[model samples]
Target: MSAVYDTRRQSIALSIVVPIFNEEEALPALAERLRPILDGCGEPYEVLAVDDGSTDRTPRLLEDLRTAWDQLRIVTLRRNSGHQAALTAGLHRSRGAYVISIDADLQDPPEVIPDMLTLARADGLDIVYGIRVDRSTDTGFKRRTAAVYYWLMRRLAGSFVPAQAGDFRLLSRPVVETLKTLPDQQQIYRLLIPSLGFPSGRITYQRAERVAGTTKYPVHKMVLLAFDSITSFSAAPLRLATAMGAFSLVVCLAFLVWALTVYATGRTLPGWTSLIITVLFFGAVQLFCLGMLGEYVARIYTAVQARPTYGVARDTDEEQQ
Candidate 1:
């Protein structure tokens, strides 16, 4: 009994997974803030920093920190595989009873982690998300757009996705295991986490602006994320295409009936304009439907190829071991 107890205790108390890109400036500050919190918890914890092919000194900085902090573990991907894939890599590699994922930008605030941990423990919840109560630092346009996006996602996805929720969240071991079972290569963790039917809650915090390094999620990445999120979770776009096709067929039938009535009454009028308009309209609709169909087909093709989601360029910890 004592041997089994000791083995369980050494497995892992907690693991914090931070996916880093060119975040050289923020890495030290993040470590400084997080180290104390983990120490305060009176439990053994390790920080897994997954560097996703950073072009800057981010990899070197992580190595220096690892030397100073024995609890630090680093994983370097072969190339830039985007944020979600990086997070997935870390989660799979982590060995912890509880795992928490956060951005390295420092905007998510490491201080809120304890609160999330507390909530997870008190409620016996499998997942606890850090929800942003306010985003005053964000531009007005961004704030409004985010609100609309969340609203639309909830309506279309038919899932209770908490508003203002980002990747900063805590998950129990069960939740982490369930996440690994999901094999979708697109990797939308935010939407996929809530669908596991686990008891969950939220910790509200005010979001702060980034302290260093440029925003990794620029306009282009934001657009891609929006597209992936919408396409992965909902069939609303495909359904809309179907509805449009039916509506167009009805309109064509109405036009045919009108033409027959005109001929029966012996009213000969130049119908070239109406005929041209109909042709263009239907042509546009067909192209639009085909485009939508192509998007789904492309996704399917990518999945069937079964490519490795990411490759590891270098791993310092693995070498040390």
Candidate 2:
């Protein structure tokens, strides 16, 4: 009774990839909501629950849920390779005409998926995004920061990542295949998706609070995710760093010329104050450029190694095979 049966003969129309990380508390509720919507869609679909090395009972819960649903499949990563890596793993493993990715925390509702699919079909879009309409549940600081981040990303990245759109979205088989061919270690799925240049649409919905489980994406992790998204997609930061260094150098040289001219003209004396200021400013600029260059170089080094994005600790599909 292998779950990994060849689907060429009987084409699977849909697959839902739910990346779980320590979501033990929300498993039952998630299943209860998802199963009915998936079943009612009238398209053959499978749910791939990617367990991103949960330390809690999330793995055990996924096993039990798989037993309850015939189309449910599980992929367990060896360790926490991160949310984006886990998502990429699930996308690669899925076999369906269309694939939808969502959070296991139940914040993204499964009920809206049918609408997304319908819109995709009607509009001939390769991808459909779920955009959050309301962030009332989030803190004011978080809400404002998210707004600022999205605005900056749109302006700087040269990619129109829709405001308030998360990883919860649907992709056609062609889009999924195209996505699989991308080979980057530091993946930013949201940013990369738009670069495909496929016809896309968005569905707006209010984002609800997590049904259960502790929030896995804390402030620090959120900041890192933002950095990863920006750095992975656009060279704008690196380019800005270069421009800044050039500007600083020019300013320093201009000041030196002015100071030397003043000395020559007997207008002022060469003193520590001006020299100290110039030194400090140049030193800060150099450090900033070094940091920016290091970020890009680190990403290149990671890609050169070509390590698999994630490892599988235990797979229900593997056992069935």
Candidate 3:
């Protein structure tokens, strides 16, 4: 049966939104693998391929594909907003009962879509996360860092947050609507979705290597994403600053006792070395805390200013279909 909103209004079963950067070479293979699975879902669907100001031939490639595949809708941003902004654009533009966001590299299988749709329909879930069951394909650095990032995120973002779930996931219309209403200047949907406390389910899959082209997310981008994830969702960094201050107090007490003992014993020694070491250590800790606090303040400043996260220059045929 087709996914329907109600008997009256026309609504698509799924809207798969793929964020693209300079991925011209990967576009064709991604489409070839993803389209058939979507068609076989036995429901009306739309693929929102959002172009994040690609400098390569990606824009032209998407345009050419649109003529052949009517369901392939394209949304071109005015400038290269980062991956998350592109996702926000696609999310806002999508009109479907359930929305799924994935990368254009085809690392996450399109085949999982059918099963996700089924589970959502059957169990009445608000969200279904595509959990990575295996990541043997990833490098040792990636695997180790991913583990640490998720571990830290779970502690800070609460226990409901999934460990291995990336951007690949399905969200019901209600969840989508909620996300649109949130005033998140930097969007991280993994944390954003869990914060809602929706009735969510999980579907496991093996993470594969890229189908073609280079990965859009480099080391720098990954680090940025991790930073956003931490600062956006939780105020743990601010709290950590408080902890650091407490530790600094304890150290000061210990130093004071030592100074008193040295004075009482009439064994006064030159304290330039001790003083210098103490100053450097405390200064470093204080600066690190300040930096962490600054990150949060920067986000707050951006939010209060109320800036638009992204702007769309054009869309494929008005995105109505």
Candidate 4:
């Protein structure tokens, strides 16, 4: 089942894209486990180990692995593009009829890949989502935050977004081509994919602990990702800002009426506390609305500039020729 990239040959059946960032510790385990599952599928496949500007020994390790495993292709980015950008690079470059994007961390098992292919082929599905059914291995905080994220996304981005599905999923060639045409600056595939309204299926699996290395997605990155997801998918935040502004105006009018009545009755307070509080409240509302507007403006600027999301430092497959 060992397969290698042949430029003259027909298209590969499957391409497993693993976006790696400083994943030196996990590379060996990932390769050991991932290769067999893909190999056993009895298909001509290639594994695109997308190196997202790793600052560790990841680049060298991938090179060494490719020496032994010809199917392993190294697609290194010139800089550390974010996860979604790296994924975009892989998807755009993949030569497989079916593409599956998975993280280098083994939390989402590679074993389920064969089942995904079988299900897709038999059911004629264009997308197969790897749904997380049991997350007992994850911390309580992580689980809670994930639940909240998915819930909010469903409400705002539409209910098509599968809960607990991160980037582990399978997409057919047609879906991949469709994604390439999108002009999104921040690619949130979880929401973006489902929004396509494609023929889809799901496969459930229990989450597992990382095989090695620390997590790349820290709390701050998670927060940033949430913001990106929110801004990229929906205008709910801008609408919420509008509602806050209206509420603030109503409150200020009510206070103005109270102040006039107090002055007429000669019971007006001498202190400036109420005036300062009102000023601060209004100021905060204005600032919040401006910030929401700024987020959308920034996205427009990025789209107008048409800057490349990622730069490829090297493609080992291309070098081989």
Best by lDDT: 4
Cα deviation of 87, candidate 3, in Å: 0.8
Q: Mind giving the per-residue lDDT tens digits that candidate 4 earns over 84-121?
A: 99999999989899999999999999999999999999
lDDT of 3 by residue, 1-321 (tens): 122423312567789999999998999999899988987877878889999999999999998988878678889999998888999998887888999999998789988999998999999999999999899998999999999999999999888889999999999999989889988476888888888989999999999999888877789988988888888888888898899989998998999999999999999999999999999989988998999988978887998999888888888646443
Off by over 4 Å in 1: 1-9
Model 4: lDDT equals 0.92
Give lDDT tens digits, candidate 1, residues 1-321.
133423543677788999999999998788888898887987767788999999999988998887677778889999999999999989987888999999998889888888888888999999998898999998897888788878887888765888789899999999889878877485887888887789999999999999777899877888788889988888887998999999999999999999999999999699899989999999999998998888888888988897879887765546654
Error of 2 at 138 (Å): 1.7
Stretches of model 4 off by over 4 angstroms after superposition: 1-9
Supply candidate 1's per-residue lDDT for 110: 89
Q: Estimate the lDDT of model 1.
A: 0.86
TM of each candidate vs. truth: 0.93, 0.92, 0.94, 0.97
Model 4 error, position 217 (Å)? 0.3
lDDT (10s digit) by residue, model 2, range 1-321: 443434421588898999889898999999999999988998888889999989999888887887768788889899999999899989988888889999988888888999999999999999999999998987898899889888878887765677788899999999999988878475787788887788999999888888987888889998998888788878888888889988997997899899889989999965789789988988988898899899999988988999888987766666655
Q: Please give the ranking of all candidate structures by TM-score, highest first, separated by commas.
A: 4, 3, 1, 2
List the lowest-lDDT window of 10 residues for candidate 2: 1-10
Using lDDT as the yardstick, the better of models 2 and 3 is 3
lDDT of each: 0.86, 0.86, 0.88, 0.92
